[model samples]
Target: MSYSWSTEEYSNHYSTDFDTIEECIKEAKDMGCKAGTTIWIGKVEEVDIRRVNLTSILEDLHNAVYDDVGEFAEDWYIEDIDSKEAYEKCENAINDLVVKYIEENGMKPTFAKVVDAELYVIK
Candidate 1:
């Protein structure tokens, strides 16, 4: 797939400081944000789903997604599925998990995409 912008929306559950290499690397394992890998189009994704605290909210969403990043590492590798399939699956999984988390916390997913994995601004 050409990564066409679909109807799939975003909701920033939370944000953390992954600006540094170490931070990015650590977050890649701890929170799933990568340092160089462009997951979306530019920089990491940012939505509008708010919580009591940014850091804590992100941690909560991280917890709700999987037991931990280790368990989901294989899924992130994308060796099992093709490139396009991987993106679609990632989108579906993220949307499903993120949407569920927001709804459960009594919030709506209505944020914007700040950046993709490559750290580019689509907006």
Candidate 2:
């Protein structure tokens, strides 16, 4: 097979216009496609646990970094995060956890942002 597919969605529960970090993660953790795992199972054949966590963290980072602290962000993780310090907080959180996953896995961080991006395609 030379092709595959996946789906991504904005965490609507937190995102009035865009998904907040907490909401993105919460939804991914609960996705039916996650195969009962509390996170998105990115690929069915070989699931990447790190990407799963990123799905959650990235949304939060986008919201906190963008400065749109809209109402309705009163979710579990969101509530814990003080909006004033969210930028550094979320950044550090993802970097500490998800980024480490990629590093340990030998997967370069930038690969996710670009198509056909992989440290090496294991055939």
Candidate 3:
């Protein structure tokens, strides 16, 4: 059967004939669909999307890294630094870690931004 797909935002459209339903569905997803926009599909039976709680995962990772850094800072043998200096250093380290994660995952979360020497992405 033939299938057609289009997006409402950019009005991007595509149509093609496929031998199987799976093929048609795959092609529809591959076609450009603007983020956070609905896609109109012709003759689509069902759709399945894998979901993950990214915020929870990120929070856990951030906390773990922050705790590790804090512990390292507190150890006198690691560095002879006072509380204020250690706090500032840990903050910078956390920002760098978050920024690197964002880049590696190709995530464009709204909160992610760069200012001066620090890369901030929430927290």
Number of the top TM-score candidate: 3
Candidates ranked, most accurate by lDDT first: 3, 1, 2
Error of 2 at 69 (Å): 24
Measured by lDDT, the strongest candidate is: 3
Model 3 clash pairs are none
Q: List model 3 lDDT by residue over 19-52, tens digit each.
A: 5445644665566433454544444222222223
What 10-residue stretch in candidate 1 is worst by lDDT? Answer: 1-10
**What is the Å distance of residue 83 in model 3 from its true position?**
1.3
| Ten-residue stretch with the least lDDT total in model 3 | 114-123
lDDT of every model, 2 decimals: 0.43, 0.39, 0.45
Task: TM-score for candidate 1, please give it.
Answer: 0.24
lDDT of 1 by residue, 76-119 (tens): 43233356666566656666777788789877644445443333
lDDT of 2 by residue, 45-91 (tens): 23334333434565676577556665444353542444646666655
Comparing candidate 1 with candidate 3, which one achieves the higher TM-score? 3
